[model samples]
Target: MDSVSPWLVILGMAVVTVSTRLIGYWVLGRYQLSSRTQSILEAVPASVLTAIIAPMVLATGLAETLAAIATLLIAWRLPTVVAIVCGVVVVVLMRNVF
Candidate 1:
């Protein structure tokens, strides 16, 4: 048994990531996707977002949940900087007062 340096582990992961992406591009370029497949691919972003956020809302405390909602609301329509500042404010106030 041998211990590997952390840099080697990180380099290995980078290589794997790049290799897979290149392979995916090479393979996918050979095919033409139908409308149905394109539609499914378009839906993937929303589904992935839900998959990521569903558990965060379910598993966290009320303050965190409220913060997430606040963040989303401001982020949905406002500038990114405004949303971030307002979200931080909302979370801070919620945590302090709740």
Candidate 2:
């Protein structure tokens, strides 16, 4: 078998991601979703976030766990973007310190 180039893999992934997004948008636009379904869909971002963060919190070292806690606290009152930025900052600082 031929070895795949890294650029080819990256481009393939980007193409697939964009295609799926466009297809999802088109499919969803054609339907009138009920309020309950809409509410469920609105929660997808949080669900995705939990899936991404739960592992780091559970399996990673002290810095990541501490950062997750700090992010959670910041998220409770501040905007999500701010919380995310602060989380990144906290993790970097904690890693450097410890």
Candidate 3:
């Protein structure tokens, strides 16, 4: 296999990503999904987050994990900007102290 240029790889990835999104949006626009499908779509963020965070928490242990969990909870309950700031602050503080 031939090695490719890093810039070419990045540009190809960007093009593929944009093309996929455009295709998805175009297709979804033409079809009306059922309520079940809509509900699943709504839950996608939470499901994805859980999938990502669960393993990280398990690998890292309680303190860091709890901080992340707390951050996520606070972020969900508070304003978007505040939530982001809080999560970042909590993670940074935990990393520095622990």
> Which candidate has the highest TM-score of all?
1
Structure candidate 2, residue pairs in collision:
none
lDDT per residue as tens, model 1, 1-98: 17998899999999999998799668866789889877887898899898997876657667768888888898899998998898778878887877
RMSD of 3: 3.3
Tens digits of per-residue lDDT, candidate 3, 1-98, equal 37898999999999999998799679877888999988988898899888987877767865568677777798777887887777778777888887
- lDDT (CA) for every model shown? 0.83, 0.93, 0.80
Error of 2 at 56 (Å): 2.1
Candidate numbers sorted by lDDT from highest down: 2, 1, 3
Q: Estimate candidate 1's alpha-carbon lDDT, on a 0 to 1 scale.
A: 0.83
| Candidate 3 Cα misplacement greater than 4 A, ranges | 1-7, 72-84
Error of 2 at 22 (Å): 1.2
Backbone clash numbers for all candidates listed: 0, 0, 0
RMSD of 2: 3.4
How many clashing pairs in candidate 1? 0
